[model samples]
Target chain A: MSVSANDNAAKVSVRGVLAKYSVLIAFAAIVIFFAIASPTFLTPANLFNVLVNNVVMLAIVALGLTIVISSGGIDLSVGVSVDMASMIFVMLLAVGYSGVVGVAGGLGAALIVGILNAIMITRLNISPFLATLGVLFIGQSTQQLATSGGQPIYLTSGYAADQFNAIARTALFGMPTPVIVLIVLVVAVHVLLHRSVFGRYVQAMGAQPGVAWYSGIRVPRELSMVHVLCALLAGVTGILLSATVKSYVPLSGNAFLLDAIGATFIGTTLSRERKPSVIGTLLGVLLLAIVKNGLLLVGWNFYWQQVGIGVLVFLVLAASFGLRRVAH
Target chain B: MSASVLHTEVAVSDEKQAAAKSAGRRFGALVVRLGAIAAFAAIMAYFVIFAPGFTSTFNLINVVEQSAILGVLAYGMTSVIIGGGSDVTEGGIDLSIAANMGLCAAVYATLLSMGYGDFLSVLAAIAVGMAVGALNALAVVGLGILPLLATLAVLNVAAGMELTLTQNTVVGASSPLLGVLVSGSFLGISALAWALIVFSAIMIVVVHRTSFGLRLYAVGGHPEAARAAGISVPFYVSFTYVLSGFCAAVASILTVSRLSASTPGSGELLLSVLAAALLGTVFSRRFVPTMGGTLLSVLFIGLLANGFQLLNVSSYWVNGVQGALILLVVAITSFARGSEGSR
Candidate 1:
């Protein structure tokens, strides 16, 4: 009986160790697979492009979603904020407005959306899922009305294109502007979430609203702040996207919602306590970005690329959570 | 004698106040139920009065047929939500139903184009759907993945498969079988509509009459209690997804037959399906998903869309209007439901 008990304990410990590092191992394995499969996979130029171009926007949006999810709220309207920012930015530029004014206008519109989201959740007491869903619907429709049935707005003139593109194109210290923006936001959010009283309060409310309320956390106010922060970050993404494309395409921002959600959840696997973290979210973004870039180079069709990512996400999550269950 | 009379008067006043409050509560509940139906009726009446050609028999028939697809989905969604209860668990909701339908339709179309027989194609499509459902069950019930995330992952995977199959191009069946099946009518009703009616009947009986049906509420209401009573919690939860799978398969088949073509965009039906399902709850006393309520909600949306089209409303505003309608209904329901809880 003593021997069997020792064996059981050892088995449990092994399971726990495996669950903890499964996602990290999977990430490393995928990277190795790409390095071996493609000669250019590890090249500095390609890697830089992945960081500066492909992954930056998604990473920023995913980071915002991480905050909301960490606070136990889901914002389906994040994409809408992004789209709204894009719409407002492009429209202002089309009217020959200065770039700074355009940026301010876009951000202001996004802030309005954020504030509205807070009201719906805090004052109305709607569940985050339903409330954001309602916001998503309203936002999508509002864009439709503004754009007159989903027409694309282009900055065709040289001045407009150049002026708008500067936001995305300008480099500081040998890095793209968006990449720099990403770094700044990451640091800010990390500090806000991990090293501050507000962050603790947000997590507390999310962990248990009733308990937090009783403990004097002012649950509604903290929760509302999380949504606002998320929306503002999403706004940043929208502006960057507009700068990249030089156009505002209706519903173009919707893709970020799913990808951000996927990344955030994958990031959770990296958390020691299964909480969302900035580093974990960045790793999640890197994982997705690598898969996307690697698969394209490996000659997979775009549609099949999504399949690869989906299957990979499921496998990684399944392996991690499945082992944790066994350990418990 | 005067002191006794004064005591009796005070007691009578207190009783009267309590009776008044009870009546007010009942009145409020009645208003909630009637309010939704009234709104729906009011909209329909407005359309009939203002839109000159709206009440034509031909238009009405078109509306019913068009609504058949949503009705079928609403039926499945209602069942899933009912089984999930108030707190949807790891496998509570099926976000992949639309994607599942798309994939099934793509597979059916591909097989038919390859000269496969109708029976084989139909069976294969349903098998694929059921297999997807089983995968969802495995993820949520067996593996403990959250229902929302699991189904969402499945959705992406299914969509990817569909895009791969069609190569991002629309796939059509050259066979005349689908055309006939779709276009063929029964006693002035389309076969698709007939199929919907049959499916609804089967669902009503299954949900309301079967032991499996009765166990769903018990499991949803309190899983621990149900388990203590010897109920297999996973079985009922997983079964609802299976039923949903069957429904998606049927919806796919109907769409394939009607369009004679399948596209990746067919997966876009998820939102409308969910909206209609949620709207159904507002018509119920307990705000639970019910079959009759779902059917009515489907009709209401159908009417709204038809009216919009007749009025020459810009298609751009359609989605916004739809979303607004859902938000409004959901808000009202939540308000009523909240009061119910407080009382």
Candidate 2:
């Protein structure tokens, strides 16, 4: 009888551990599978390429989304902010503006979207999901109007272009500039979300708004500030994206929207209370980026890669939640 | 005696103030309830005066016909939103509906291109939609995933499957049945418009008159109460998704019939569908989504698009205008309700 009881306890502990760390385990397993399946996957060059090219922009966007999700709101217009920034940045440079001016314009455009979202959510009493969705639609139309039926704006070989590209291309401390930017933003967000008073208030509000309100957290003002901060982070990504590609492709920023949402949600599995965290979001971005790159290297078609990613997301969440159910 | 008289005077004034406040609220509610219809009428007036060719019967019929597919899709979304109940984060949306429509169309076209019988292909396409819906239901109801994320996963998977099956190319279908669906008119109305009418009729009966719909509304409006009353909340919620899937399948058939081809990225109608369904809420004083409201909202959007084209006012402005209109309508609706509207 005692032996059986001991065995049951061991099983319970195993399930508990699995439930808590399923995302990390699945991520590791995917990495190992890719490394074994593709000879080029383990190389430093390929890994660096993944970090700099595929991961940084998505990481920045997901990090921003992480803030909104942490604040108990969803920002479907992250793509709108991203597109606005890139569009304004490219347009400014095309019109003989300097790189600094273009970057400021880009960030400013993104900030407008955030401000609009804040107003709708806080003042007008619109739900975050609906407000952001409305912004997304309006943003798309605005882009189309500006570009005359959604045409791409190419910035090929100019002083401003070269200067803009340097934001992404320049290396700092043996790391690419964008990657360095991503790391700094991640650390700042981590400190903001995890180690600061404001972060605590945000989390408290998210966890229980009624409680936070009674406790005097100044819910509406803080929520507005959170959205603005989130938009700024997405703007940084937009600038980086335009710099890397050297063009502003209308509606291209929307491609990151779904993936960023997926990554942030996947990252939530890493938290004990299932809150969004910066480190967790970064890891989630890394996992998705690696899978995307590995699948390409492994000769999977684009459609199949999407299927693979969807299945992987479902499985990771299922594993974590399902095991938690069993453990309870 | 003087003190008592002073207190009585204060109470009488408070009662009068309360009565006046309630009367004002009643007037606000009336305005909010009429907001959507008034906007529709106003926009129609503007187009009739400003846009040439907008008042033609042919153009009006064309707008209604164009609204058919979106109408059907919006009705399905309305049911899901209603089932989702009061919480925005709950199971109120099916983001994969557009993707499901694309995949179903692809399936139908691919099967016909492979020399399959028309009836068989249609059935197979519908089956695929049902399967996708079942998968979504299993993930959301059975496994307890957030409705948004679960539908999003299904969207990616469905879209990818569609792209894979079509090899990222358009697939054409040619058949007599499809021809009738696209061009055959009865009583001066297109068959597509007829389909919308039939679907709307069915939705009205199912959602407003049937026990199933009552249970669904119950589940959405108050899950705890519904559960206490012995309603299977999960079953009803799952059924909404399945119904949405079925609607998408029906819309796909019409889409293929009209275009004569299944193209990649037909899922771009997602935002429009969402907008129509969301806009439906403004028609109700309580801000509840209804099939009637959704059908009207779809027509409103269709008319706007048609008028914009006639006026040559840059078709790009339609989406922005639609977004702005939804915000304004919902804002007014919520504002009229005061503190209760904040949710």
Candidate 3:
């Protein structure tokens, strides 16, 4: 009888461990699989390329998404913020504005979207999803109007262009500028979300808005501030993206929206409470970046790479959630 | 006797106050329900007065024909929205609908190119859509993933599949059925418009006049209560998704027929479809999604786009106008509903 009891305890412990770390295990397994399949996958230079060239902008965007999602709101117009900022920034540079001025214009455009979102959600009492979606549509049309029917603005030459390019291309202490920027953002968001009293209030609101209100948390104010911060982060990514490409293509920022949402939600699985977290989101971005890079190295075409990513996302979430169900 | 008289007088005054409050609430509800229709009427009036060719038979028919495919898609979305509840965070949306339509179009074209009969190809394409819906159901219901994330992943998969099959090129097909679907007309209306009407009628019966419809709504409104009532909540939810997939297939057929080709990247219709379905909510007395409301909303959007084009307005302005109009209508309705803004 004792032997059987001991065996049952061992089985329970094994299941608990699996449930707790399924996502991490899946990520590791994929890494090892890629390392075996492609010899260049584990190279330091390739890793650096993945971190700097492939995912810096995505990391920044997903981190911002993590913040809004943790505060019980969704920002479907994050792409709008990115596109607006990139549009304004490039337009300024093409018109002979200095890089600093261009950056300010870009951030201001992004902040406008955030402020609009806040007003619609708080003052007008619109749901976060609908309000942001409306903003996204309006922002798209605004871009089209500004560019006279969706023309791409290229900044190939000039002093402002050089300054803009330096944001992504230049390196300090053997690290790319964009990578350093991403690191700084990750740390800042982590501290803001996990180490501050405001963070606690935001989380409380997210867990239960009614309860948070009853506890004297200013839900509306914090919610507005959260959206503003989220948009600013996306604006930073927009600037980086413009620097990397040396151009602002209309609606290009939408390419990152779905992926960032996917990564942030995937990051939620990393927490025991299934809440969004900065470090987890960073890791999620890394996983996606690695998968994309590895698929390219393995000779899969772009379309197939998308299929791979979709399947991977579903599988990871399923395994983690399924295991947790069993554990309970 | 004097004390009893005084008590009766107080009771009469209290009853009068209660009646006044109820009357005010009813007025507020009526205003909220009629807001979208009022906007629709106002916009139609403006277009008729200002836009050239706004009342021409050709443009009017054109608008209805163009709205047909979207109308069908919106009907499916309405069912899903009703089945999943009115909450945005709930699993009531299918982001993969447009992508599924694109993929089904690709499948139909590929099958035709491979020398399959048109009827057989159409059936196979629809089956693929149903399969996609089932996959979404498995992920969302069985695996317990959030509906938003699950559908988003499926959207990627469907789009990727479409791109892979078509190889980023348009796949054209020719058949008598396809030609008729595009150019054929009946009773001074296009065949596509007829399809829209037929589907709407069918959906009205299925969603409003049937027990299945009631159960689906019950499942969405309160899953726990539904389960307690032995309504098979999972089955209803899964069926709604499958129904949405089927609608996408039908829309795909119309799309492929109209263009005579299945184009890559046809998933861009997602936003317009979502807008139409959400706009439909304002037409409902209880602010829930309804079939009639979806059809009307689809026509309204079509009319707006048509009028803007006729007025020599830049196409870019249409999107902004649509967004602003939706925000305004939704805001009025939400305000009229008082503090229940989260819905």
Best by DockQ: 3
**lDDT per residue (tens digit) for residues B1-343 in model 3:** 9999999998898789767766766687787776667778888999999998899998988898899888978887888888888777655888899999999999998999889988999999899999999988888788777788888889988998998898999999877778888889899888888888889999999998999988988998899999999999888989988999999999999999888999987787888888899988888887788898888889998999999998889999988988887788778877776634322
Clash number for each model:
1, 0, 0
How do the residues B255-303 of candidate 1 rate in per-residue lDDT, one tens digit apiece?
A: 8877878776877798788878877877777777778788888878888
Query: What's the i-RMS for candidate 3 in angstroms?
Result: 1.0
Worst 10 residues of 3 chain B by lDDT: B334-343
Could you give candidate 1's per-residue lDDT for residues A274-317 as a string of tens digits? Answer: 78888888888889899999999888989999889888887878
lDDT of 2: 0.88
> Residues B40-153, candidate 2, lDDT per residue (tens digit)?
899999999999989898898889889988998898789888987746665578889999999999999999999998899999988998888888888878777777878888
lDDT of 2 by residue, A1-328 (tens): 9999999889988987898899999999999999999999989999999998889999999998999999899898999999999999999999998889999999999999999999998898788877888889899999999999899998878786687767878999988899889889988999999999999999998899889999999999999999998899899999999999999999998899889988998888886688889988888899899999999999999889888888888888778777766776
The candidates score, on chain A by TM-score, as follows: 0.97, 0.97, 0.96
Candidate number with the higher TM-score (1 or 3): 3
Worst 10 residues of 2 chain B by lDDT: B334-343
Cα deviation at A295, candidate 2, in Å, is: 0.9
Query: How far does residue A171 in candidate 2 sit from its true spot (Å)?
Result: 0.5
Q: For model 1, how big is the CA root-mean-square deviation?
A: 3.4
Give the poorly placed runs of model 2, Cα more than 4 Å off.
A1-13, B1-26, B341-343
TM values, all candidates: 0.94, 0.95, 0.95
Against the true two-chain complex, what DockQ does each candidate achieve? 0.56, 0.68, 0.70
Candidate achieving the largest lDDT: 2
Pairing residues by index, what is the TM-score of model 3?
Answer: 0.95
